[model samples]
Target: MPDLGKYADAVLSSYAVSLVLLVALIALSIARSRRVARELHEVEERVKHG
Candidate 1:
């Protein structure tokens, strides 16, 4: 990695914030996809029976 120590504390803080946000976003998207897949399966089952 580059020399993060050369930058000010604000820079380090910004990088930390960005990393957290990206991780959260990726996790949320994965959860959302799983939920959608489950819902889709339920809907398909209902259509097949009714």
Candidate 2:
């Protein structure tokens, strides 16, 4: 491992922030994809029954 003795707090904080942002982005993308899929399915069903 690298030496993080002098800037340990800064390094840890940076890593934590990056991790939080990445998780947030992934969650958002999954939610949006689910919403779009549901809409598409509904449209397809309407087309088939109409």
Candidate 3:
């Protein structure tokens, strides 16, 4: 890791927070996508049969 001089703590903490938020966003997006896909599949099945 490069020396961040006197702002090491601040910079590192910011990076950690940003990384956590990014991971959370990705997880939420994937979950929403799966849910939407499942709903679409169900709708399609109903349309096809009924």
Candidate 4:
């Protein structure tokens, strides 16, 4: 890595925070997708039976 000089700490911390937030957002989206799919399946089954 190139020397960031005195700004190294600030730049690296910003990258770290951005990566963490990106991962969290992806995780939440996947979880919500699974939940919605499951609920939709249940509703479909209920409608089919009734």
Which structure among the candidates has the greatest TM-score?
4
Residue-level lDDT tens digits of model 3 in 1-50: 99899999999999999999999999999999999999999999999999
TM-score of each: 0.82, 0.87, 0.93, 0.95
* Candidate 2 lDDT by residue in tens digits, 1-50: 68899899899999999999999999999999999999999999999999
What is the lDDT of every predicted structure here? Answer: 0.93, 0.97, 0.99, 0.99
Which segments of model 2 are wrong by more than 4 Å? none
Off-target runs (Cα >4 Å) in candidate 1 are: 1-7
Clashing pairs in 2: none
Q: What would the per-residue lDDT of candidate 1 be over residues 6-42, giving only the tens digit for each residue? A: 6768798998999999999999999999999999999
lDDT of 2: 0.97
lDDT: the better of candidates 2 and 3: 3
